[model samples]
Structure formats: structure tokens, C-alpha cells
Target chain A: MTKLMIKEREVVVPGDIIAEGMNYLPSTGTYRQGQHIMASRMGIMRLEGKVVKIIPLAGKYLPRRGDVIIGKIIDVNIMAWRVETNSAYSAMLSVKDGTSSFVRRGADLTRIYAIGDYIITKIINVTSQKLVDLTMRGPGLKKLDGGRIIKVTPTKVPRIIGKEGSMVVMIKSLTNCDIMVGQNGIVWIKGEPKDEILAVETIRKIEDESHVSGLTDKIKNFLESAKR
Target chain B: MAYKKRSDGRKFDELRPIEAKLGVIARADGSAYFKIGNTEAYAAVYGPRDLYPRFLQNPEKGVLRCSYGMMAFAGSGDRVRPGPSRRSTEISTVTQRALSPVIDLDEFPNAVVDVYIQLSQTDAGSRCAGICAASMALADAGIVMKDMVAAVAVGKIDKTMIVDLDYEEEAFEGEVADIPIAIIPSSGEYTLLQMDGRIEKEDLMKALELGKEVCKKIVKIQRETIRENFKRSEK
Candidate 1:
């Protein structure tokens, strides 16, 4: 028998029993102990059918494989480029994975991705040792140019993206701005100065109100009002 | 000696008035300002960011570094130094250990979480107060922890067990024993235990039990403060 110990969207702290029995499964920010499911962090409970997860209200980003992230090149070497992923662990982008072109050995990698240059990349792998491997060969992955990068809590990134990219698409259409969201909470926005500011403000509002219900509708209303 | 009430007119097992507030520092990742009777302390938490000085970085878990300091005017009579003293260093080490167990450092690798505790007023149990406030600050910063740590000092005053000792009570030359204890209320696990002055075996047990009860009450206040802050931010 599966028993839900907490309501949907209720805040819970670590060690709080969120559920009981094996009929339910635990996801991110939660852990399982025997027949009980417990919260592993302080966050709001998210019940998706039989899958229970917790969305943290605050904290730095923890990189995961296959996540599209924005990284700043911190160091360059012959074999790879060390990129700061806004996480505790820095990521590495090998020459072969970074670009399709084949270059000879001893080639200056700085020309490809110099220090302090922000790039939109994907996390190809993250080992148990926390060594992150990044790739920039995918679609929509490249160096961000002439755009302002704003950060929000990484846990709120899903809210900014909305359900199936609805929220981000809505913002882009309303402001005519080209925006890219990194799984690590870095947002790159390229548009008119006024539109850029509006987009940033709207994203921040979404981050702040992510835990509230009817947020998508609220954001839609906000964008409409701003346009007027 | 005849039994007498404390200068503050509190009972033997009574605790000092406690006030705890979270997010007091706007610039810090998480901050708390708290007062226990006349003793006031402020604590701020920063990072889980990359630990610099390369050699200090831990590969498996994040490191928590705490710095405990007393302001020059914090003491009642003589002005104390503003920087870290030998006593402050010892307190900082013990405070760090008290808080380290609760935080799930494995979630953050190669990072350092720095906690800075400043005592603005001294009333004998400031270190305990600092630990309590620093734990609140860590939770407010949204660091994942198994539980919050709460601490209190229990002492024998004129053969009476008192929960919190003020400056005068602490400095009394009478036969007394001051034992400061920090515990995770939910688990009843002691993270810190220190004793000053002599204590008999039976009296030590009594003091531990009383300290645990008082710490439980303090933990309740800590949780309430964090919850209230979260509620306010929701709006």
C-alpha cells in the first residue's frame, strides 16, 4: 500500500518522511530508506503520478549528463579546455568533442575557445569522480556573442523553461529576443536593450514565483501587460 | 547556601529569552542575527563555491570553514581585541565540527562553505549562541542538511542546575561547573561537548539531560525562524 505522507507542493526538510511503501518511487532531492521515502533536502514536494521529487528553493547547480549548460572558459590546453560549469566541478571540452574540424597536435586551443568566453555547451558525461565532459557540437551549441548572461537559481530553470518550453517560447515571441537557458541557471539574452531588460525581469519573476500554482498563466498575464 | 533566584529572576531550569532572525544580511548567501538574553551574535554563510588555494580543496566532499570572532566592545568591562584570539580559534574549530555533520557535503564536491560568526555582546554562553545562529544561517542559505544543531550551556550555580549562565553567574568563584553541549535535536546526537570546572558523575548526567531539553526548545525556534523567512519570501 502506497501512502503519501505529504501533499503536493508542500515544503519539506531533510529527514522528513515523504512517503511509505515501495509502490511509490523517489526522485531528485529525495531518498529511499527500506519501505519509506524521505526528503534529502529542504524543498517543495513535487508529485508526478507515482514519482515523487523535491524542487530545492535555493543552492548552486549540480551538473548532470545531457544537460545543456552555459560555461565560461577558464583555462585552455592542447588537448581540452577547462570550463567552469557554475558548479563545484569544472568541465572539460576536448578538441575532438568541441569541434568537428580536425587540427594537428600543438595547435593553439585558445583560438577555439579563449579564456572568459562564454559558450553554450552540453554535458556529455559526468563520472562518479565528478569529472564533467562537455561537447559543443550539437545544434544551438556555440559561443554566445554580444549577449548579457543573467543567473537564477538552477532549481528554477525548469520554471523559466515552463512545461515543454512554453514559457521561454512565449517570452521570445513577446520580446523578440533570442534567449538561451543553461541548465546551470545561466541565461543568454540577445535583443534590443529594452527587450533584454524586460526579458530578464520576466525570468526573475518566474524564478521568484516558481513554487506558486497558476504561474504560467501569471507569467502570460505579466508579459501581456508589459507589452501594453 | 540558601536557594535564591537568578539575577534575572529566572528558575534553575529556565532558559534566557532567545530571539532568532534569518536573512538579516542582504549580501550574504544566508545570514542570521540572534540574541540569547543579553548575548547577541550574527552569523553569515557563503559559498559551496570552488575552494581556492587548490591544496585545500577536497575531492569527495565540501569543506566547511568557520571563523568565530568577538568585537572589541563585546565584553562587559575591558575592551577585547577585534580579531581572532586563541579562544576564538578554538571555538571556531568546535563550531565547525558541530555544523559539519548536518550538512550533506557530498552534494557539493571541490567546494568550500564559509561561515563567519560575530559576537556583538558577551554573556558567557556566546559560543553556544554562535553555533545555534550559524546553523540557522546554513539552513537559510539552502544548504542540504540532515538536521539543525542547537546548543546551550548548563552549569551548577550554588548547587543548582541552571540552563544558561550569564556573565556574573559564569564568573562566580563558588563551587560551579559549566558544561556546554550541542546536539541535533531530532537524533539526540551530541556534536559538541565541553566542560569547565569540576562536575560529579551524577551531576554531569543531570546537566546533559537538562541541556538536551533546552536545546530541543532552541531548535524549535530555529525551525520557526527558517519557516517564517521562507513564507515571507514566498510573498
Candidate 2:
């Protein structure tokens, strides 16, 4: 018989048996051993249909291919611009992949993307050696300007966006701020000074209360109050 | 044989009071400050970040580096040197070994996780406490692991097997074995085992058993601290 050993939303530590039978598939933050599925990190257990996953409360981001992320240009070389992906691995944005417009060989690459500029890019590839390749040739992918950047836990990025973009859209409409969330936990907000500050506070609140139930209603109430 | 009871009045199998706190350092990815009786230690975990020097980077797994140090005033004697001494280096090696088994290093390639442990006040079982605190710090950092490691020192004092020896008991000379053991409580697999001084083989077995039992209790406290940290963050 299939059995779930842990209650949904319960906190579990490493090696705690989350499920006892193979009927349950283990996802991220968990591993399988014999007939048991055990948590591999300290986090809250999330049960979704047949999948048992753990949502870690804190950790550094590890980049994956095809994720849209905000990165800082740290170094510029002949062939590519090195982008720090808010992770241990640095991604390379080659001059060819950097822009749709092509130019002569050995053209100055720094002028296109200068150091310390934050850009939204998509991960094109991640080699087995952890060499990450990034591309900026997509819609809404380019250098960010005249916006303030704020950081939250990478794991909370999904919560800030909410289900089907409901939460983020609410915050943007209420505060009149244009917000862009990076999968790597960096958020860019641009608006009038007062509205930008309000957006930042609302985002922080969502991050702090992401694990609690009824958070969507609570955040909505908070935004309504802030509007006044 | 009747023997003089310990000055602190603990029974042969009794352990010192434990107090542990997680995420004590705001700047660190994970941190813990804990006290076992008079022995106070702080451990901080940083990274899964880039490994420096390039050569030490493990392509297949992350490197775990531990630096164990003692404050100059931690000891009872004259002012101790304020750097990594021979004793500190050895302790650091053992601490790293004790914690490495639990961490899933393969999850982050070319990364290095650094655990820094400072014993600000030491009784006798400081190394054991350091291991416990370091493991909690790793958990706080959200590092994936197979299990959490708990450790304790069991030594023969006055021909009696005592759990968690203090400074006064450890100062006893000759024939008294001080065996420190760290284990994954759920799996019962030992990650670290070291013995100083000689004891009968049978007594060594007894000490190992006692050490494992006490480690379970410590593990419970570590888990509670981690849970409390997450609960507070929820607000």
C-alpha cells in the first residue's frame, strides 16, 4: 500500500523518511532508498499528487539551463562577457549571442555590455563542466536601467510571482511600479520613488510569509492597506 | 568500588546542559552558537560558492573546509596564542571529517563550503561540541545531506565511564581514555572516532555505546533549533 509518512507543510530534516513506499516519487530535496523516500535537506515537505518534494528554507542558487535570470557583468574578454549568475558558476555571453545585430570581428565588446551592468538573460546551455552559456536575444531581455535592485531568497521567487502571476501583478498595479523578478532571487523595480519603496516592502513581506498558508489573502489585504 | 563523585555532581552517564541557537550570524549563509555546560562555541557556514585557488575545486563534488580555532582566553592557563596552532589544525581536520559524510557535496560542483568554528569557552569536549554545531550550521545553510551528525566524548574517569568529560576530568593523567565519536544518529554510522589514552577493549565498547546514546539527545536539540529558526522566519 502507498503511504505518506509526513504531513503536508511539515518541516523535515535531512534523512527523515518522507514516504515509505515507491508509489510516491521523490523530487528535489529528496532521495530514494529501497522502499523509502527521504528528505535530503532541511525544509518543508510539499506533496503534489504523486510527487514528494521539499522546499528548502535557505540556500544559494544553483543555475540550470533554460532559466531566465538576472546577472551582473563582472568581466569583459575578447570573445565573451562574463556574467555572474548569482551562483557559484559564471555564465559566458558571447559577442555573437549577446545581440541580434552582428558587427565586425574584434569589435569592442565592453561598449555593448559594460561591467557592472545588470542584464536579464536566458541560460542557453550548461555543460557538464558547469560552463554556462547565456543569451540576450530574446524579448524583454536586455540591460536594465534606472531601477533599484532588491534581493530575496531564491526559493521565494516563485511565491513573489504567485500562481499564474497573480501576486506580482497585484503589487505592480497597486503600487504603480514595473517589476521584473529574476529566477536567481534578484528583483528590479522602477517607478516613482514612493511607489518603488512600496513595491519593495510588499515583495519583502511576501518572501517573509511565503511558507504560511492563506498568504495570498494576507498579501492582498496588506496591499489594500498600503494603497491608502 | 566506591568512588568520589564529580564536583559538578553529574552522574556517570549524565550529560551537561545544552543550549543551541541557529542563524546567529546575519552575514553568514548559516550559523549557530551553542553551549554545552561551560563550553561555548560558534560555527558559521559560508558558500557552496566558488572554490578559490582553482586546484582544490572538485569537479564532481564540493569541498568541505573547516577551520577550528580557540579564543586566547578560552583556556584556563596563561593567554593562549591567537592563531591556528597545531592543536587547532588537527581539530579542524577532524571536524571537517565528522561533517563531510552528512553533506551531499555532489549537488554543487566546483563549489567549496567553508565551516568556521570558534570555541570561545572550552571545557573538555569542545571538539565534539564543534562537530555538533558545525553540522547544524550546514543544515541552516540548507546544504543537502544524508543525515545530521551528532558527537560526544566519552572518557573513563576514576575507572568509570563518563559521558561528556569536563576540563577537570580531562586533566586526569594516565590510563584514562578519552574517546570522541561522531555518528549519524539515524543510520548509526560513525563519521569520526578517535581515542587518546588506553582502555580495556570491553570498556571501549561501553564508551562507544554511551557516546552514541548521548549523541542522539544532542541531535534532537539541533533539530529543534533549526525548526525554531524556520518558524521565526515565517513571521
| Highest-scoring model, lDDT | 2
Checking candidate 2 for backbone clashes, the offending pairs are none
Per-prediction interface RMSD in Å: 2.2, 1.4
* Tens digit per residue, CA lDDT, model 1, A172-208: 9999999999999999999999999999999989987
lDDT of 2 by residue, A1-228 (tens): 779888999888887889997799999999998898988898899989999999998888888888899999999998899999887789999988998887578888877889999999999998887889999988999999988999888888989988998888988988989899999989999999999999999998888788998888998899889788
Residue A63 Cα positional deviation in candidate 1, in Å, after optimal superposition: 1.5
Question: Where does the lowest 10-residue lDDT sum fall in candidate 2 chain B?
Answer: B1-10
C-alpha lDDT (0 to 100) for residue A158 of candidate 1: 90
Runs off by more than 4 Å, candidate 2: A1-3, A21-23
- Please give me the DockQ of candidate 2 compared with the native complex: 0.72
TM-score of each: 0.92, 0.96
* Candidate 1: docking tier: medium
**Candidate 2 chain A, which ten residues in sequence have the lowest lDDT sum?**
A102-111
TM-score for predicted model 1 compared with the true structure: 0.92
For model 1 chain B, give the 10-residue run with minimal summed lDDT.
Answer: B1-10
The lowest-lDDT stretch of 10 consecutive residues in candidate 1 chain A is A8-17
